[model samples]
Each structure stands twice: as structure tokens, then as C-alpha cells.
Target: MTPDEYAAALDAERSARNDRARYVVCEEHGAHALMRRNGSGQAWGVARHVSQETAELAAAFLNRLKEDEA
Candidate 1:
């Protein structure tokens, strides 16, 4: 799937959750890594790894998607 599509899917899943949470996407070793963040903006754990492009897309869309969901 394309990076934007992947990011949309992730945002949808995150929006479906019952609690307020956030995620940070980063590039690691030529791959994308997702890190879960708590309400206080602290990193909790790494969730998954995706493509570098996907990570870039996700980072770009994260805030916009959250605002849209709100």
C-alpha cells in the first residue's frame, strides 16, 4: 500500500481506540518505526515497523488526523 494509505489506516485504528493516546513515527535503519506515546507525551513503547516512506507520511499526517478526529 502507499504511505498515505497506510497512514490513513493507522489513524483510523488509533481513532477507534477508547483512550486518548498518541504515536510517533520515526525512520530507523531504512525502516519506519512506530512508538506509542502516553497522554503526557512520553514514549511508552515501540508498536511496529513499517517502510521509511510510510513513516514519513504518518509523521506528516499525525496531527492533522488527530485534529480531524477531534
Candidate 2:
């Protein structure tokens, strides 16, 4: 997805009350990374990679991460 599309999706996910945490696919230094915001609202990369495949994997990982935390 385009950067704007990613941003919209991230915003929507973050706003959803059911979502225990938010995951974002963002560009950094010409590459994409999966990020999550800390309790302090600072974005940090959970996984960094240059491929969309890795981003998809990161999304799945985020789901499991939430479940584990619960």
C-alpha cells in the first residue's frame, strides 16, 4: 500500500477500542518497517525490513503479541 494508505489504516487501528495495541507499516530511510507506539506515544520499530512480505508477517506477529499480553 501507499504511505497515505498505510497511515490511514494505522490511524483506524489505533482508534479502535478493541485493539490492544497498534501496529504500523512505515517507511524509514527508503525502507519499510513495522512499528508500534509505546505508552509514552513514541513510535519504535518492532521489525525492520525492506519487503512487503515481512510487513505482512509483522502484522501476524502483532496479533499474537496482543494475545500473549492478554
- Which candidate number maximizes TM-score? 2
Best-fitting candidate, measured by lDDT? Answer: 2
- TM-scores of the candidates are 0.40, 0.51
Residues 1-70, candidate 2, lDDT per residue (tens digit)? 9999999987776556335356778878877888886555677788788897788788778867775554
lDDT of each: 0.65, 0.74
Q: Candidate 2: which stretches are off by over 4 Å? A: 1-20, 38-41
**Clash pairs detected, candidate 2:** none
Clashes of each: 0, 0
How good is model 1 by TM-score? 0.40
